[model samples]
Target: MYMKLKCFICGYEVYGDPLTNTQCPRCRGILAVHYTNPVFKIDSRGKGVWRYSSLLPDVGERISLGEGLTPINNVGEIYVKNERFNPTGSYADRSSAIITSVLKVRNIDTFTILYEEDFTKSLTHYTHFVGLKPSISIPRIDLVDLDDILFFISRGIDIVFDNKPLNTLVIKYLNPLTVEGLKTIAFENYESRIPVERVVVPCETGLLALSILKGFKELKERNVDVDYEVVAVSIKNRGCQLLNNVREVKVVEVGDREVFEALREAYEKGFKTKPLSALSLYIAENIGKSLAVVTMGFKTVTSRESAVKKLILEILSQGKPMTAYEIWKTKPIYTLRAVYKAIKDMENKKEICFEIVSKGRRKIKVYRLC
Candidate 1:
């Protein structure tokens, strides 16, 4: 297992230190945590983003808000990875998970960050998950959205407006940890073994596109056969040089009118996404059999959920209160992780009830038809 913070331009490497600095001391180039020769294997026992922990840097007990493993729906011809179900309801939770974990191991008590609503809120939440304090400085709080303002206030985040945060980490594109977090989307796609020729992503600053591309690149570096090419969809010819640096990235420029047209088409097709995400939808729809990442991804697609549920139903139809593990033992397909999520959903909707039993030494939650 090889891991290091690598400078893309100067090729300087820092091993075992993701936070040595976000830039190369020699060239001041952008740094990203690079993994090679990794014993990458899907840990089915692990939950959420941590399922791919083998590919990520070792952060001793990770802090998670159930960030990854969002559902990918095959709506019409386009496959969309919906991230709306994340803990903070944003993909930034993925980055927050890694950031908080690294901070925890480093024994960093307090860290300040420049506030960008989604990332700021996510980092604040995860930091508190491990009892770490974050002071957020938003230079344009007056211009910030009303709901976002209330969110910060509700969480008791320390916010400073229109001021410089002295020597604090800026949670912006240059952040390598952000790259580490965003790249897991590509890993999820690969592990799921979803066959698609192209994967499309919305490009604002190109970090998401670059991170995902780097992930696939790492896959190729480790001799894994990767099939799809990453396509960056933008409104204008609107991407930075970093996106161009990757020779394999396919860039698509869309017209504003065309975007709106696609927006309406997507709405009628029962897909609701922001204009940025609509850009990916437009490209994916035009080129059928493509998966456009809406925001996040999941351990296994809910496409398997119905089948797994049917099996669990048959097991519990006997009216016997069986433990979740007992139900999984009868499942001929789907991972136990999938079974767990299915029962959780069923339990939530009152389709299943717990038959608590006091055993000799252990108290167990047994499931039966409600």
Candidate 2:
């Protein structure tokens, strides 16, 4: 029940709440959850990452969205771990699930998130599902896509631009619970019974790479022999500091052309993934018996229908009849097709009513809440 938070750099341990004290007070290093009497056992009947609960902390109720257990595809000589199949279409769902569980167990209902690239979207979805009020901090709002921006707004998630620090739970890669969840990827890979000569991963904050290494280390501690090397690919020259001096870790930088080529190749092969994932495949192309971890996929046009429908109902509830185009321009989270689909579904359920009105020489459909 009581998991010790140990600093990754200095080995300083804290016995209190891991969620509140994310960073080591002494060395300012990131803290990792250290469990006592840790044992590795795969529950044959368990689903997703929950199968490895014996190795994870028992953080009350398990919050999951069917994350993990992604298919391992053999492309030529490399094995690609397609993580884009996760519930929220990103590997971050694994981390978000564990973090949300931890927060829920601690009776924390609201949290803040520092918005990163793909991870932010996945975190937003998970947090919303778990009934957590997420206050997001970003450098610039325009940097985020219109769909994601509207989705967050529709969910009533607060967006702020100030850099002021908050005392509430802030979701970030530095959190130990996140890393603990990510370790399941390594566990799943080890369980696949495939000969792993090398593992290729895209290194953003170095959290995923470090978590995978820790997972393999846990296996090694249990007397399971692991001989594979870790290859971290990055788009920049200077990678993350977390993997700065890690042993047997090779960091490679790839150009945009290489990333685009890998993306094209992966899409052609029926894997529509993000560029970060494509970078992993690009690095794995030169390695022998490699396993590339594809992190995320492109968001489908109609993926956020429920959220868009809720927004539409809320807009109509304000006693103003609005056209579909007006709602689309206001929310902009759902594609035109998805908005129409939600409208049709709501109309059939008698939750809303629509009327055709003529303005000038054009006729448009306007909807109002019933």
Candidate 3:
């Protein structure tokens, strides 16, 4: 299984360790995975993304948590790829499974992930399942809730809060393995046999968008008549450097308010997802018939000893009253709904008390320790 890493910018190719040499030696650009004598076939008996294993790299002993095969639904004329239905409640699970499988095959039992708390969670779950140890680096502990932090800690995953790079395998989007796993999303969409005019994806780093485009490219290589525009949407002021060199990609920028509105609309349509995921829906409203990938679903932090509840308790334990919004913004890792749920649950157990506070024209409920 000879795979080549080609620089997405200069087209310089190299046959080296992808885990070690992530950037191209010539152009220092991001590398994409290319298999020699690529074969495209479907194994109907395979599960999740493995159904299209013939199209993916030959990473032995497929590792999976039943990711992919997400349902595609129509909201009016727009088609939505509900990726939140993935095993870890995120599309990243698809890549995590593939990356972990590669590590397992290479006998690399340990790896580290940089940033992207959501993606880290999926990777952590898969790595742990495959008997591999994974450490994650985040900018700050406050950026994530306590439960997730504790969960990783309990799994013996080193949680580092520094810019220093670990010597071990680092699982960033730059790693072509992750992008290779993400391409399966496009394969699944193509297999659906639906008419797709365009694909609207929320772009942060743009790897997912690029992977989708690569998947379509592979389909085209297989003599499949695939014609679809790739649209990358970013929240205002956030640029996607990954899509800069990619051609024919239409980039759109939206504000925070638009994303909030999209979240509300998506919720009204029975989809409770993150703001980034909702951005796809916002773009879909403008474009005619397009496929929008809802990346993740909003979940309530229900653990009593979870970081959100612990932070709420710590705040009220000071004997100072605070509103739900105040608690939400204080340590914003937890959603407002999750905070409110924790407050109600704490109140039920007589762990906290609340009072009504009126500020100008608005009335708000404030909470404090009992």
Candidate 4:
């Protein structure tokens, strides 16, 4: 007889074949493979994420790219697990390989990979490594400049700008195999001598957060004393609001405009939280969610480096282009040669872009988006 499988969310007993229902009918949450014993110790014979395969669903054929044992660094008080060291320089590679493997088994070759701007390179890397083809979609606003477009094209990435595909796939984009891939991170954490007090994930979407929750639950069942709060950090403007609703937490939403305005107001007047709507909202929201606010300082997008991003931000702000001189006059601090050099470095790293426009006697360089 086949083993009985159950829904991970509602714990509903799945009576029929497991392949028929991949998700729970009650809560519509993703289904997890059930075993007779919830916990079991396995030999450390296997290398990388495959060691935790016992806890994850069986993939007919495993497509792996050495996606485990990333070095964990101690940065200040927090342990910074540098996922950038992953095969594709992003944490998504682990999950991407698994997802692609499943698709290969199912003979689903031509599938679209709808992702945020950040995941484009990572996904492309993994897809190529796994020998699969995928069409990627990102926001138009996210792709700021023509040079940015060139970069994606150079990487052989097919770009589309519609949310329909994402809406269709829902969480299935993170198939069971993908979630299982994420469990590797937790497994590593459990094996560590000093367990992490809190897990911080860069969340554009909530998939990683959801996977982390599952991984921790499995660790708990294994009798690992993994007591830590899961913190999902996101950009003030680009963050997905659905995470709060899904987690059933009271969340505060903030935007870049609000943050900048507050900063400007403080510089002119005084530094206080009362005037900044975003800062105030963030304070309350962070407290409610038990999240630590970590500020990331953005380098100035200057003409020598990425005139693209600065110009894009400018155009979006008021649908008008600003010359390098105008920009310098308006924001002199950002026009520094050092700032421009840093921008150039970022561009080489494929982080942003720059464009120059010619107008009469004076040529104006405009920084575009992305």
On TM-score, the leading prediction is 3
Clashing pairs in 1: 69-297, 69-298, 70-297, 70-298
**Alpha-carbon RMSD to native, per candidate:** 13.7, 14.3, 10.8, 13.4
Worst 10 residues of 3 by lDDT: 298-307
Give the alpha carbon lDDT tens digit for every residue of 85-118 in model 1.
7898778888889888888887787668776656
**What lDDT is reached at residue 240 by model 2?**
60
Instruction: List the candidates' TM-scores in order.
Output: 0.74, 0.75, 0.77, 0.56
Give the alpha-carbon lDDT of every model: 0.76, 0.78, 0.79, 0.53
Q: What is the lDDT of candidate 4?
A: 0.53
C-alpha lDDT of candidate 3 relative to the true structure:
0.79
Ranking by TM-score: 3, 2, 1, 4
How big is the positional error of residue 37 in model 2, measured in Å on the Cα after superposition?
1.7
lDDT tens digits by residue: candidate 3, 96-137: 888877788888876678867568888888889978887788
**Which residue ranges in model 1 land beyond 4 Å of their true spot?**
1-3, 14-17, 24-29, 165-173, 237-241, 296-370
Number of the candidate with higher TM-score, 1 or 3: 3
Residue 331, model 4: lDDT of 51
Query: What shift in Å separates residue 93 of candidate 3 from its native position after superposition?
Result: 0.9
